[model samples]
Target: MKPKTYFLCTVVFLASVAADASLSLAFDKAKLDTFLTTNACKYCDLSEADLSGRELRGADLENAKLGSVKLSGADLSALPMEKRTKRTNLESANLRGADLTNANLANAAASGAYLREADLTGADLSGADLSSANLKDANLTDAKLDGAKLDGAKFCGTVMPDGSKNDEGCAP
Candidate 1:
């Protein structure tokens, strides 16, 4: 092989390696532990963190900031009624494809959050504010939405709490 050609191939390989490195984002376990122990991490920068497929049941994240955080396939279910206190605050967070089965999100503020294809089965969202949030293709089977805000929320192909599908908010 020619020297010039070899140099070109090496440059291309290096560039690809750099791109892959930049694309990889890891979850911050220390930050998660801090939030869990203290029960307070308001405005904490956890953007673009990967927390997929983890069990974070009964986490109290009220008023915490989790913008652009990746929690796909994670279990965020709430604690039992006897051990319940404040609801988790996921306001304006990117929770696309996350699992929140049986989570007690009563009075939680999740306005304008991205929850596309998320599983919220049996979650209690009573009095919660989900206005303008994306719920496209999300499953809400048996989830409680009594007095919950849904004004301007996207529900295209979304499953309702009563096990019915709704496409009222879908755009043609």
Candidate 2:
């Protein structure tokens, strides 16, 4: 092979390896399994984990520390009645600044979660418990919140589920 062609090939190979290494460092199947089987992950750190676009239907993640976790476009929706073992748990998890756009989060237990500035546009949050969650400036445009608990939940500058903007939680 020509020297120039060999150098180009080597650079491309190095780049691909770097990409793969980064992805592998972000995802851990063992940790995921632990959360699935235990139903409890209090203070479990999953920061910067790339879980985007994953199908996590019926996953129980109650009290798991998911700070800065990338769950954008992921499916955390409820399963059918027959297939459901329990509701998904995300209660009190540090979901601050997470991207959940177009994600399905129906019936999730997310009370007291730190959802500040999270993107929830077009996401389904029907029947989810969001009581006392800090949802300040979170986008919920075209999102579904039918029967969801929003009492004491901060909504300042938040986009409502019906596409309306709210400033009730915004500071004066």
Candidate 3:
């Protein structure tokens, strides 16, 4: 092979390796398993996990790293107050770019969660405590947000449930 061709091949190989390594580090398998089995995985790395269609009711995911996670159609709602272990706690969790389309977040305590750019289309967020959550650029089209508490929540460039665009906190 020509010297130039060899060097280019080496660089491409290295770049592919680096990309694979980064993908492997995206999430912890043990942590994802624990969360799936027990519905609780606080303070763990679950970024980029494909948890679609999982029953995650009342999950305790406080401070979890869920960036780019795929939780479409997952249930994140709390049980009846008497039988509940706790509300779905996404407080301070990093859920940026997460795909939560059609997920059930009713009665969840998601205060301070980072949901920027998350797709919440058709999600049931009724009664959720989203106080202080960062929802900039998020899509909530057709989502049911009845009774949801949005005190201090950021809505820059967010798509509202009623099909309206919200730039309430966006910079001019």
Candidate 4:
């Protein structure tokens, strides 16, 4: 191979290796598992990972950074049915079609996130920040949304299941 070609290839390889190393150092499955099992819901960083179609019931991920993560079709119904709550920093995360029935997400920051077709039946979302979120075709039956922020959020074709549109805290 030419010297120039070899040098370019080496640089690319090193850059890829460095990126992988950084990702591995940042997120580890064993540590996440330990935190999940213990329900220690606070300050977990799970950014830019593929968690699509996984079961994460009762996982304490409060304040976790889940930006650019693919959680499409994941089942999040393992949270407490009565006190259903969220503690994660899901800003700009993709959660399309995820089941979050009876989940409590009071004060959760879900701004600019993609939640199209996600199920959030009877969920508590008081004081949650859902600005600029895509909630197309999402189910929010009997969900509580007192004091929630939906500024610039898209709710195209979203169903309430009970046939009631969300008027509480919605800005016109």
Q: Give per-model TM-scores.
A: 0.63, 0.72, 0.88, 0.51
Which prediction has the highest lDDT against the true structure? Answer: 3
Instruction: For candidate 1, write residues 1-172 as lDDT tens digits.
Output: 9999999999999999998876664335677668657655665555466555555555555434454465545555444467554455566666676666666666767778788887888877887889988999989999889999999899999999889999998888
**Local lDDT at 128 for model 2:** 86
lDDT of 2 by residue, 41-134 (tens): 5567666677789877766666666766788888787656765555667878878778888888988878898888788888899988899999
- Residue 118, model 1: Cα distance from true site in angstroms: 0.8
By TM-score, the candidates rank as 3, 2, 1, 4
Model 4 lDDT tens row, 46-101: 55555656656545454455544445445443344666654445567565665666
Give the higher-TM-score candidate: 2 or 4: 2
Candidate 2 has an lDDT of 0.79
Q: Each candidate's lDDT (Cα)? A: 0.71, 0.79, 0.92, 0.65
Task: Report the C-alpha displacement of residue 79, candidate 1, in angstroms.
Answer: 13
Candidate with top TM-score is 3
> Which residue window of length 10 is worst by lDDT in model 2?
34-43
Which residue pairs show backbone clashes in model 1? none
Residue 92 of model 3 has an lDDT of: 95
Question: Worst ten-residue run, lDDT, model 4?
Answer: 71-80
lDDT per residue for candidate 3 within 13-118, as digits (tens), equals: 9999999998876997888887888888889989999988888887889999999999999988886667545688899999999999999999999999999999
